[model samples]
Target: MKEATEGRLRLTILGGFLGSGKTTWLRHHLHERAFGRVHVIVNEAAAAPVDDALLSAADRLTLLAGACVCCTGQSDFLRVLLGLCDDRSGLADPSMRVENIVLETSGLADPAAILAMIQAHPVLVRQIVVVETIVIVDALNARTQMEQEVLCRQQIEAADRLILTKTDLAAPKDLARLGATLRAIAPGATLSAARFGSPLGLKDPWSDDEPFALPEISEHDSSPINACQLDLGDTPDWTAFTVWLSALLYARGDQIVRVKGVVVTPAGRLLLQTVRRSVQSPEILPESATPVEGDNTIAVIGRGFSQDQLAASFNHFSA
Candidate 1:
């Protein structure tokens, strides 16, 4: 790991599209102590954040939920960064000071915007040195995402290193094509593959594959993706909720990019997640893993729908 210059703290921006496995990769890296004496800042576009629970391995963890740090949450993000710098400066022992700060940006964030913000800020520019921007790509969905969402393309273009995730779930040919497509989007970025946060060698080299055709997506072409929180109340009917979620995705999967939350069930606190139309197997969190203030509420991310409509749909289904 390269040390920061002039006693500045290094910052690594971890960015990706919705459900691209950013948290999984960060969690593994933290467990491995990849960033020595690191402080992690996780920004979630949704008010109900579930990723923080999986990132307890960080030396210090701060959650900036309910907004995208690149935009809506810029003030809070800056405040947090400034606070970290202040705390470090106060430390008497130079060895005890934090070495690195890893910012896991919300999936919806444009890393370039965040970088520009940091670079433009006089204080942050002096105190923090952005080491790299590592963007995680969803191997199974990048082609489709790049075609539909302008933000996805921007994320790729801003990456210093692109980590293609969900490599195991994608077909070999598809993975190769996606890798090539990513390279084409950002020729300067180094590419690698990972599965469930573990590094994996690419089966087919991107150089040997053809890049997928990407359409020009205008910023106004699609409805803006937004996060809508649905309160499941204190006790949620797990089976019924699952059925309703399945039906909703079946009907509006294209409009609903991601669904995630932690709900208390008979078995345990189950962490539920869905990427597009595909539902991942629910993982039971450890007993010590506690949900934030907004537990039993799921954040549905995408566009073309309202929170009122989602709530009504769930209520009718459960009733």
Candidate 2:
């Protein structure tokens, strides 16, 4: 971790179904001039590591797609993320100075589950807090997918920013209808749209006060399944204990659905995530160097577990 002065590496998670122009939305985040020293984690379910156009920079990018981000590769993601803070190899010259991390999950991934992984980590939750859960919806097939695929519906419902993309393919009336539907589903969020080839209207948020305050959730939206907090505190005895603990949880892989949290390891602060079953490496972050923005907090979600258990594990590592 770079020890950011403010304890902030404002993070944003981009979740959308397959080919919904997520990469397009991300390209805007990557090329913007103000987003200096940004890091990206790309997740895929295939073995072929496809290049991420959004992470256009050869050096600052880390791809984790092919990884069973929600299952098989959870630990691998954890190890690699912890390694990033320590590994000077592939990192940029300002290697230690890492700012925001943009996570690109698989088309079939579950955003909520992955978010829990990031919020549960003891270190990451403290440093790199999530600014928003932006779910990009495709105008064309979104309605059909939502109707037929429950996972698809969950993705849209769990988002803080509902981005409608691929508008070119949808009829004007259909697009308007879909947009209205999404607004109803997430009345609390700020809504917006972007076409694939067009420049996204979003400005570099780092230039201002921490990206708009976490979205205010309506009472009905207050459930843990969709709402989870990633808390970051002092580094954990992550050496062998954390590794063993991760393994124990991974062994029960099938039962674990989603995990997302910012974790602080002895090496550095990182973003941890799991979707479906595979996990993406915690995006290692440091605030010792960046300005401290706020207090540290981390939380994770599981299918049949208690938040107390999660809190207890993290408390065990308090400095």
Best by lDDT, which number? 1
Candidate 1 regions exceeding 4 Å error are 1-4, 288-292
Predictions in order: lDDT = 0.90, 0.57
Instruction: Give Cα distance to truth, residue 124, candidate 2, Å.
Output: 2.5
Q: Determine which window of 10 residues in candidate 2 has minimal summed lDDT.
A: 204-213
Candidate 2 structure quality by residue, lDDT tens digits, 24-89: 577765666445666777876543333352357523777774455655567766665555544433
Cα shift from native, residue 221, model 2 (Å): 24
Per-candidate alpha-carbon RMSD to the true structure: 1.7, 16.9
lDDT of 1 by residue, 173-206 (tens): 7877887887789988888888778898865555
Looking at model 1, report the run of 10 residues with the lowest lDDT sum: 286-295
lDDT (Cα, 0-100) at 304 in candidate 1 = 93
> Number of clashes in every candidate structure?
0, 69
